[model samples]
Target: MALLVLVLSAIPRPAHAEIAAWMVFEVGSGEVIDQHEAFRRWYPASLTKLMTAYVAFSAIKQGRITLKSPVMVSAHAAAQPPSKMGLKAGSTLSLDAALKVMLVKSANDISVAVAETIGGSQAGFADVMNKTARELGMRDTHFVNPHGLPASNHYSSVHDMALLSRALLRDFPQYKRLYGYTGVQYGKRLLRSANREYLRRVRGANGLKTGYVCNSGYNVAVSATRGGRTMVAIVFGAASGLERAAKASALIEKGFDGGGVFKSHPKLDNLKRPGSVKGLPPDGYCRRNAKPKLEKLMADYAGSAPMRAANSGLPGVRTAFARESGRTRAAGIATSRADTTIPRTRDKKVDWGVVMDRLIGAQRRSDNLVRITLAIDPNAKRAVPLSAPSADDASKNVADAFGIVMPPRGKPDSRPATQPADTNTNAVPVIVTVPTRASDGTPTPRPAPR
Candidate 1:
């Protein structure tokens, strides 16, 4: 029996048997509230973008580049794989706009463009990333590329990522807004962020980044603030996006509720650990052959009731509609214009008048502006207007239509605000606009009414 037990113990177990790496750190006190397998090295994937952003911020601070600096796309950048901006070789955008595209869209091509622009070449940029990582005491981290594409030398630990997250918050506070954007309007295209959904669902959640690749699994470095206290959570090697988010949320919630305080937890910077180990490939746990193992992992990290309650809801329709209203105003569209832009079908243009009549009829029956808009042209950028109202008024109309209750100005909710019954009926209709394609298939905005 002893000989058999010794042989079994020496055999390798399935990846699911190992706990995923995770850590919760309190920003104010620098306390590591909790942690598991934090020192184990894992592929950073696009989490490498965080370091890329860091290097850019540092360059800006040192007067090497300005936000207005132009980042020109090169043939190399344009050739990068998907999760990219698809800009042509000679295309250029301001660094400010490029950063938004890279961070929120997680565009691999933009990452390389920014790298080449700032560091003279992709290889040089890798040096800068590594140097910065060392200065920040990211002991187990390495960078072989700016985009975190699969490379043998590209890896980091959850512990290192938490350290980097703290550095971002502490060093360049002004750029915090870059991490929280739900979506960025890049010309006629609106690029949305997966992190946006988490921001809407989590209470007090704000800025951070997320990453995924088959080798890394789903990874996220998320932070939330409540009552002046902030917590940062790092999760790695989850089987899916939902699991990754759920684990991060649970860790942050646990930190905020004094789970890390009662006991003596080590300060984040001072936590000692053994030497790093090679990260295990997540294929077994993340692929089709691992349903039972995935189920077990989910059960192990399943969130608490409070977390479930917090994340439960239709995504904030009020926020989405408000963003659309803001976009309309930015485009200088007139409130009095009755006509809305309609999308073109394969060979024919959609008739705006007929679409409006159908939408108005549907609105009368269902009061759902979104549903009505989708029925007309699912890809239309702006919401279908029933009547022209000021942006604020239009947003209120959308909120009422979606049964969402907007909080009074200057009063934000600590949790996802409980929406009450919709009572407003006089919803003003807003104009919707769709981009028209040029001869070369480039999208151009419809002109505002004179």
Candidate 2:
């Protein structure tokens, strides 16, 4: 970034380079400090889920669905794409589980399953998505597909992305923690987050999805909060993943450059509550349908502890660097990354083949379904160090695997299989732990399985 900053500063005048698009703003207040080609059109890739989740949250609030609402997978929905929850057509997820799947993996099929279950089909839910966007002042955005896979007419501007971020904070503040999912596990399988920063050691950084498509380059919408102050930043189309994070850090610093909203509220403690847990809701269809006991408390904090005491400091948003020895100073920040010098080439065009390897917690051929709740200590990163469940009592292991119980009693269609199961725990590991940033400050690129 210092080199880029120096390069930008050295530019005698603004050059017409396709620099990445980005912006940063205070959530509650509509303050835009730094901006580039924020209005430029770009492909959202998976970031489209932010809108989908927003509408789902709205439905939950409206009593149309519950966290426990059951959404059954349909053959059509199951056929969509990988990055899926891999449930069969007959399987059902509580509304909550469905949300989790979508939030966590940016699963495409689960998005459709939730849409169909809630609105009766994809077209119906899309109506809600577009209308909601209009109301949120996302004038330059449109949703053609529930999952943000390629669609002919789908497009959005970075400016619009910032607008959606603002709405998420203002309207659905209760579910903000949903944005912070680094990785999650279901029973034995490990599902990692695609957001590298969260998987790494960056603190205060929660989430907003990361995305890429050949035409879109790379896009990431990230929000980080410390104390009571929260800032939302968006970076679209970057040359490299490391560059994206660095650029985002700059935008965020610029946003904090002016002043914070919590300046007057000295006692306001910052709290990030349990947001919609990913995978579970969107795939499991077990989101809150009816407000439960202690709903207010649940509303206040979704999952994590709150932060108290605020820090007062400003981080500058620097783009092109200015050499101390040189007389040059960066004029306006450089906008696109499509400079002639930095070649625009992808390592390999993404081949969306066998995208569902992680689905079914590792695909297995059997009529029986295994459920397990593998307790994970957040501080404990390695796989659960426990005696083998299978080597012990088979029935108890089955019970533990499916700890919550099968179709138990809720839905008449819910049926548990008497068929015997494989004893292997068959651990399917998908979550990729991004190496913590070395103190020397160099990014070690760990390729996330596409």
Candidate 3:
């Protein structure tokens, strides 16, 4: 169950059960038409790569990185999950081919390769990501990796995603046509699009992204134009692909009703997830609370936030919200064409910011609401904080949220220097949960984002 884009027979419909969506019209014009769960904290999935692509493209436009830039494939990048171009170690690709594969197939490895080649390592590129998010004003978004892989801290909302869409269309019009692609051919393999049905159902449906994670559920960000008017539609927590498409269509049809982008209430707290934070990189500031965490700070200043569209009346949206909303957990999907269904678990409890970061690589971690579904199994049952034993990990982590009272790193030399005998200062190692293997116990190599 790779997160590959697949062919669909027909357009999708709204969920028969409870679900939500968010929509905006005339991006810079501040017009919104229809919406449901616009602000809901769903997985951005691969749609996050849009920003990754945008950043890379921007670098090229600015004469920083070029299309001919030869990015290398590190062992770490080569180890990424699948849907990839299958480059081996010592292999190199031009920025152009890498970007194309990323946008067309949503390749995860390629994304990392690009990040590493452009920004250095995954961590270094993350700094660039945070800065870009701040500049774009993605208020509810935080990126931990270049390729969106469903890390807890990597979460986003429709409102913030819409903003990125607008910026891409406006600021990066030179690459605007990249998103509207129906399909592309690579190495004798004709890669089709996951948006064919969407293109058919909507009048001016051009291009966009889709996403899904067990916790985040079915998410989508779409754009279309008609009658000299253009609009973007976003859906989160949908029951299925059918529902996602249907709701997007409804928003597009309803939105176009007003002659263009219209005005409707937006989910104000979309970025307001159950967490605290200091803004990401370059210009850091804290936005933590009771159970404050890095997420709060990172999300505090994301541009294109639901706050910008405070009047949008949509469900599942919030300026800040808990990990789970009061909706049912939709079925888990493996690709963009998976069947849709209403889920049962929608508990608004813990924060999922870090979880999202672990999912997508840092680059695509925006609140973009991707429409592609993934086989990334939800560790819902074992979903708990990873803490060190001796000193209360929860308490220490909790304190770190409030301020620098407890920095992320403690004095490594802090130990009981017994005068009687020789004592070692070696500390216990941090417990990092290992990623689950694919169903067949194989390492999944994800392709770049489509």
Q: Tell me the tens digit of each residue's lDDT in model 2 across 1-450.
A: 899999988866422223357777777556666666666666777788888888878877776666665665655566676788766544566666677777766778888777766655566667778888898777668888777777657878777788787778778888876666665566667565566443232335667777755455567888767667677889876544444554565555545654455443211112111233111111111111221222222232211111110112323542432212223334234343211111112344321111111000111122212232322233422211112223223232223322223223334443457755445677664432333332333233221242
Q: Pick the candidate with the highest lDDT.
A: 1
Q: Please provide, for model 1 over 200-221, each residue's C-alpha lDDT reduced to its tens digit, 9 standing for 90 to 100.
A: 5566777698888777778889
Q: Rank the candidates by TM-score, best first.
A: 1, 3, 2
For all the candidates, what are their Cα RMSDs to the real structure? 25.7, 21.6, 18.7
What root-mean-square deviation over C-alphas does model 2 reach? 21.6
TM-score of 3: 0.56
Instruction: Output the worst ten-in-a-row residue range by lDDT, candidate 1.
Output: 365-374
- What is the clash count for each candidate, in the order shown? 3, 63, 107
TM-score of every prediction relative to native: 0.63, 0.55, 0.56
lDDT of 3 by residue, 91-149 (tens): 66666667766776677888987876666556667778878988888877888888778
lDDT of 1 at 113: 79
Q: State the weakest 10-residue window (summed lDDT) of model 2.
A: 353-362
lDDT of 1: 0.67
